[model samples]
Target chain A: MERPHNFSAGPCILPLEVFEKASQSVIDLDNSGLSILEISHRSTAFVGIIEKARELALQHLNLQDKGYKALFLQGGASMQFLMTAYNLLEKKAGYLDTGTWASNAIKEANNFGKTEVLASSKSSNYNYIPKDFLVPEGLDYLHYTSNNTIYGTQMKTFPKKENTPLVCDMSSDIFSRQLDYSQFDLIYAGAQKNMGPAGATLIVVKEDILGKVSRAIPSMMDYQLMIKKESMFNTPPVFSIYVSMLNLEWLSRNGGVPSIEKKNKAKADLIYSEIDRNPLFKGFTALEDRSMMNATFSLKDEQLGPKFDKLWKASHINGLNGHRSVGGYRASMYNALTLDSVKVLVDVMKNFEKTA
Target chain B: MERPHNFSAGPCILPLEVFEKASQSVIDLDNSGLSILEISHRSTAFVGIIEKARELALQHLNLQDKGYKALFLQGGASMQFLMTAYNLLEKKAGYLDTGTWASNAIKEANNFGKTEVLASSKSSNYNYIPKDFLVPEGLDYLHYTSNNTIYGTQMKTFPKKENTPLVCDMSSDIFSRQLDYSQFDLIYAGAQKNMGPAGATLIVVKEDILGKVSRAIPSMMDYQLMIKKESMFNTPPVFSIYVSMLNLEWLSRNGGVPSIEKKNKAKADLIYSEIDRNPLFKGFTALEDRSMMNATFSLKDEQLGPKFDKLWKASHINGLNGHRSVGGYRASMYNALTLDSVKVLVDVMKNFEKTA
Candidate 1:
């Protein structure tokens, strides 16, 4: 059966090969005569897989000797919101409230210590990224979301600061592009978007950035302890991490981050160009702050909504419906989506323009 | 290939039908044209699955009209070890330390409030349950492990209490037997044992048991908040819960807990009778306190260790090797293990005795 072109905001599309391998593993992993779902996480087979996942993550990011340790954890990025604060925040922290996820991080941090929203795009309903802002002095760290899934905005340029550390929620666009990963002191992403599934979170934390806080961090959330234990602090979401490893292997085999970035840009550009040129469509995010991952847009003529929805659905495009807050469509072009699929969506829009 | 009889303590065996259906869903779930791993948890398809899982849990437990709410949560039973304390341990709690897992629960609760060890079997290395214990009055709750996975002891009878609420960690044997569901206010289990996989936790909480604590519960750990949101407070472990729902469906069709309990007893009795008669092997837990889920035993003649190990491995048995702390073998028979599989292991043991 032919698979549909899926553009889900999260728990997003994955490589077909990875899915195929994972399906076989769910039946019997590596001829061990046990489903990957049933094997003990403490077993040598699974431990090897997890260790290799962390190693490959660091290797792909070129952060192998850069003092950053990669860990696979549970509870998604939501749990990381408070955990980042519990492990880092002492007196106060600065947050860039660019989107819902960033605001949620600030809200969770307030329970741990003083949190100041240094900049916010909320005033504009998160249509654009806030640029002109000063990084306050003496803050433990300045946190921000690398890409906003709902708002379709990406921080193309990171904030520069002295003395304070940088933390990022890179859930949507971690490996879609190349960057100097050493600049951030801490980074976390739910494995759903560009990685694998929804159960595990990928955390990359610098060693020296931990152990400064006075609070007793829960063992599950403690980055320092997770590093010490090699992310076996708890049972460690085995199936999610296993598939993540397979996805990472796919990424590495296909020229790693830079190659995927090229494909991602092509997909984004194709869809966004259609949104810009088509008379009936208009993008929701500002041009400069537009996401290379999620292309949020709406119909210029409201009456065409039903027809455009039908066209995309008929074209076998799944999850193109935008977030409710934005009231449009979001074509999430993650790392795995083919450029040909993007062309198919663009062609669908052209046909709709001719028909509607 | 013939499937091995997997006896893993946790992340253990699942029904073959559940595995097959789950494998297909990983490719295309219910012909929705989306991999179960990639679909948004907020989608109607997944929402229906989660709702059915909760409804089925209540129905199987005969607690549908008993004012109980079932939730599929993330972070496994380890997170619940902390959450149970965060939500319920306001001033002090009573804990019955039956084995490693119960002691771990007590240790985590200590960070929340004062805790009294009401009863413990530590003196005997947790080989038996401490029955001659009282559930002291004026306590926030009495927490105990329903099954000791490592020690192979199960609490066949729970302590009778009047005022204190009862909380249980039923990770090892949740659906393998039937019990008085209305007796406990809260019950949590890691789904890997009898349910499905490792990432999701099955929690059954009485609506009235929450909101008594004064401490600010983390949103992810707050039972009241989870109840209000129907466990969609965040993106859950989607794939894990979906398979768990399928496994629950399988359990319901295979005659729920009462019927499974009969088969579970038959399996346990067959293995224990062999351990008592074979002369080469001896049971670990005392006869009266032995578990119907995990039957732990050791070789009477340690010199025949390699010979016995090879014999079982040749017979296509998996995960019979015990934990390092206990230098023996533990055969964990969950709801999915069949009577014929138990016979295969019993036959292997008899063959080993005759040869040795």
Candidate 2:
């Protein structure tokens, strides 16, 4: 089977080698005479896979001694939006609303504790991340979604901490860039975007900050409970975690985040530069805060949008449609996305310009 | 890759056709040139798959106009344990504690509201399902685990559920028996046991019985919110749902649950008869209440248990070890396990008996 450049946003393209390794195990896993699905989460074969995956995820994030523990959990990242609040929000929490997912996270966090939206760029249709957010001193934590996947804006820097903990929902752009552990006390992302599959969520949490919440959390939802059980609180999504490990292995082989971040910037630069140069299209996000992972752009002529979509789909290009919450084309170039895929988009843009 | 008789308690076996069909789609899904993972959850490819899987599941259970909505959500049946209590436990809920999972359910449910143990079989080592448990009047709902997977006991007939809505965590024994779903208002199962994989959980709930709870429920944990969104409230486990759909199709082709129930009984009878007749071993659960899905037994000469396990594993018989919480062997016969596999186990028992 010939592989095309897959760019569907999360549950997105895993590496081709990952597909080969994962598919082989489906038929016969680890010489256990059981398909990987049938292998027990408690079995020795699966334990090794899970342990390796957890270690690799932590190392990839450079989270060693970062006052945080990594957890592979089910229910994707939307779940962590709630779990994070449930576990952390004993007192008031502050949020910076940048885009759709960030607003959703704030709404979910509101259900648990008082939420203060320190700033919002919604009035500008979220073109730029809010830079002047009022962070009240002594709040429980200052929470923000680091990257707006839908809006294609990112917080290039963390808010100054007045001793309040920082929590980030870094679902779309976690490993595609470099980060300092000193800035944030907690971070979580679904493995689908930059990591691997859809089932597992990678949570890095400061251990001491947990268990301070006063509400009666369901045991499965408790971060401290999950940490004590070593992410085996229930049968973890075994195969997804294994696939994520393979993805991380690929990342490590290609030189870690610094190397990948440079590649990611190059890909985003090529596509965004095309949108800027061509008279037919215009970039959507605030230019100062445009993302390296998701590039949201729109045609200057509205009628050409559908035509462009059809053209891309015909070429077997995928997941370039902007989120339904926003209307345009969003070319999400996560870690697995190649510079060559970006070249195809650039070519399409140049051809579209010649015709328009 | 020779297949073994996989008796994994959960994260269990699936039909070969289901795996083959699913694998083909993994790379090039539904003619979309996208891995099923990369395809949009809202795409016609996935919505149809999710809806079809729900319909097939309801069909297999013979449920009709129960006004029940089927949802495929994450967090497994364990999440349902709490969600059931949150939705229906406005005043109080009743639970029947049977095994490890049952007790876990009760513990989670207690967090929502007041819970009473209507009955328990722990005194009998969970070997006999309670025949005469009392159903207290005026309860919001009656919660029970249909099959105790670890202890290998099943309810032959539920205690008469009248007026009270019957909510069951049917995680272990669903699809293995012919059931009158009218006896219960709600039924849910983690798909790992009899259905397909670990990532997706199936919940069947009556629409009219919801919204009675007084507590503020988180959106992900709220059944009504998920049903309203048709389980598209968040990005769901697309690959897991697709595989479950393929498994459902296979089950329908194999003549639905009625046909499968006959085979399940035959398989259970073969293994149990050997355990009863052979001097080397004895069945753990009572004859009337033993589960068709999980058959637990141990050597009469306790010293030979380790030797028995070694013999089975050496012959490539896998996942036969009992849960650590319950120290004995448990052979799980999910829908994917054929009668031939059961025959092989029966022959092994006979050979071991003669040699002993």
Shift of residue A52 alpha carbon in model 1, Å: 1.6
TM-scores of the models, in the order given: 0.98, 0.97
- Expressed as tens digits, the lDDT of each residue in A1-356 for candidate 2 is 44566666666776677766667676667666567777788888888887887777778778776667888888877898898888888778888989888888888888888988999999989999888766778788888888888889988898867668889989889888988855778888887788876777888887877788778899888888899898888877776787778788888988989899999999989998998999988899889999998899888889988778777776667778788767888988988888998898888888877776
Q: Give the candidate number with the greatest TM-score.
A: 1
**Collision pairs in model 1:** none
**Candidate 1 chain A, run of 10 with poorest lDDT:** A215-224
Model 1 in CAPRI terms: which quality?
medium
What iRMS does model 1 reach? Answer: 1.2
lDDT of 1 by residue, A1-356 (tens): 77888888888899989988999999999998899998999999999999989988888888998889999988889889978998999999999999988988888888889999988989788999999999878999999899999999999988868878999999999989989888898999999998899999999988888899988876666788888989876677899999999999999999999899888888888999999999999999889999999999999988889988999899899899989888889999999889988998999999999999
How far in Å is the alpha carbon of B229 misplaced in model 1? 1.6
Top lDDT model? 1
